[model samples]
Target: MARRGKKKGRPVSGWVVLDKPVGMGSTEAVAKVKWLFNAEKAGHAGTLDPLASGMLPIALGEATKTVPYVQDGAKIYRFTVAWGEERSTDDLEGQATKNSDKRPARAEVEALLPAYTGVIMQTPPQFSAIKIAGERAYDLARGGAVVDIPAREVEIGRLEIVEHSPERTLFEIECGKGTYVRSLARDMGRDLGCFGHVADLRRMEVDPFTADDFVTIAELETARFGEAGRGKPSSDGQAPQEEIRLPDRFEDIDALLVDTVVALDCLPQVSVSDDTASRIRLGNSVVIRGRDAPVEAEEACATARGRLVAIGAIEQGMFKPKRVFGG
Candidate 1:
């Protein structure tokens, strides 16, 4: 048998809530963060378009297993709609497909908010990643094929105007997963008799994560170099002698990581003893003790001494381990 080479990168694990910059796709962002941390594995909780900027929670190593929780969570976005022209892609990146001279008034725009809230059927933008018979919709759209994508149900928790003018309208919305801000602008424009498209968009929150958890790429770069890269100004106002120092150790930058269990904030959690945790790690079902413990849970996590032990289900007072974690 041939000897397999050891996997590259360290087994560093945790979440890196990135304040993703515009013009960088989600895949690229994940790759960059993975390289920066030299993690064994990496993934992102949700996809953020290259044109949009804001909170992008990235998972490394064992944290990747918890991505589904974050992806399924509610999202809040602030976007601007530029009136007059509707683009093929429904954003600034595409060519104009429809034009309108009429612009909606502030009151008229506000009036439309009530109709958009709650559960609504929305057709996703043509230039989206949605699959059509194993082919990506964006690929088909790029090839000049206009697909008749069906409208699907999406929940909008809140929709309110942040600012409004005759030429443009800014709105903030809290919506469920699979909701597209571009589609929202396009549909609203059609209803108001003034064709419009997304001019700028920024995601402000994603479930457990908010702007408070954001760490920018620039900040990451600075953290990588450490204080050795900083130079103190000379008192004489001239120049200070250069002091060269070796770069900080790898562990220095790991401080920015949010605990892997943070992603499970929305799920039910159970605390287990060390012996029980060991059993869970071996893929065994253990009886959950305590009167306050949940009788059953479709999705839950078990922790041992504050560390994640497993993610699985609780049924009939028993916790069955599905995905176990390492120390």
Candidate 2:
């Protein structure tokens, strides 16, 4: 008699929405999630500063193929502004550079909010990762070199007050990607006739990934490594989770993360006929007859076969490989 091996599980694929906790860098969190799944490919949709907390979308396996679609989405955040002070880093973590003897009036700050809204020019801080002359601007700044950062255009879709104290003010923000919340706080302080710096910060949304759909870091630990509620543990001893759903409360740290399976929305998808599916299993793009690509597609997605815009299908007996979706 011969012994038989157990059946292997379906290949794991999808997205992970981590409610990134404060005090950790985005890169570090992605590393832990990657190691847990041991997936061959993974990537994050947005970049969050280590000093901030909020929603982060981590794509796994085939989901990595769809990263571009997600990365280009709009973003939102909530943060604090300390009145009568300014910092070098634009946030509470930076060294104090200036202060005011008196707090700016609340009405004055409210009036300034209108000017900050809509499209406006902004300068990236020198103590940032922006590259210049083949070196990081932050590196140059750290090396005691002064560099001029020019102002460019950015849109502040919405800026509103959340709360205000004699010493600190909080705000909720919605803006396009690449907009810096810290810079906004700093600018607001200046526009309001007082010194100001970000005292705290947290992301609320990343286009498709909303804070409502986020799960705190501590919650991920429970779902991935705990008991029956741990979903499905990976073969590598890391627990796997089922589909993640949006939480009722934006502040829940232990809510379940959205599903880990990657899905392609807003793109043309064609189900291959029985015979054609088998022919392309050898790993090639398939070409078919009588198929009409979607009319309302993106400008890039409208290219003819082999332009990198088209995927799937094979010509003749061979599959044409254009863009490989899986990492």
TM-score, per-candidate, Cα-based? 0.92, 0.73
Judge candidate 2 at residue 218 and give its lDDT.
51
Model 2, 1-327: lDDT tens per residue?
988875333244567787877877778777766654444566898878888888888876656766777777777888988888888888877788888876866777788888888998888876787788889888998888887887878888899888888688888888876687777878877776687888889888777766567665555545544533334333333344665332232222223434332233334444445445444444544554444533232222212321122243343433354444322
Q: Give lDDT tens digits, candidate 1, residues 1-327.
A: 999999878898999999988988898888877766767899998799999999899999999999999999999999999999999999999999999999999999999999999999999999999999899999999998988899999999999999999999999999999999999999999999999999999999998887888897667656766654343223322224776343446665688888888889998999999999999999999999987899899989999888899999999999999999996
lDDT of 2 at 37: 49
Error of 2 at 7 (Å): 21
Candidate lDDT values, in order: 0.88, 0.65
RMSD versus native structure for model 1 = 5.8
TM-score of 1: 0.92
Q: List where candidate 1 sits over 4 angstroms from the true fold.
A: 227-248
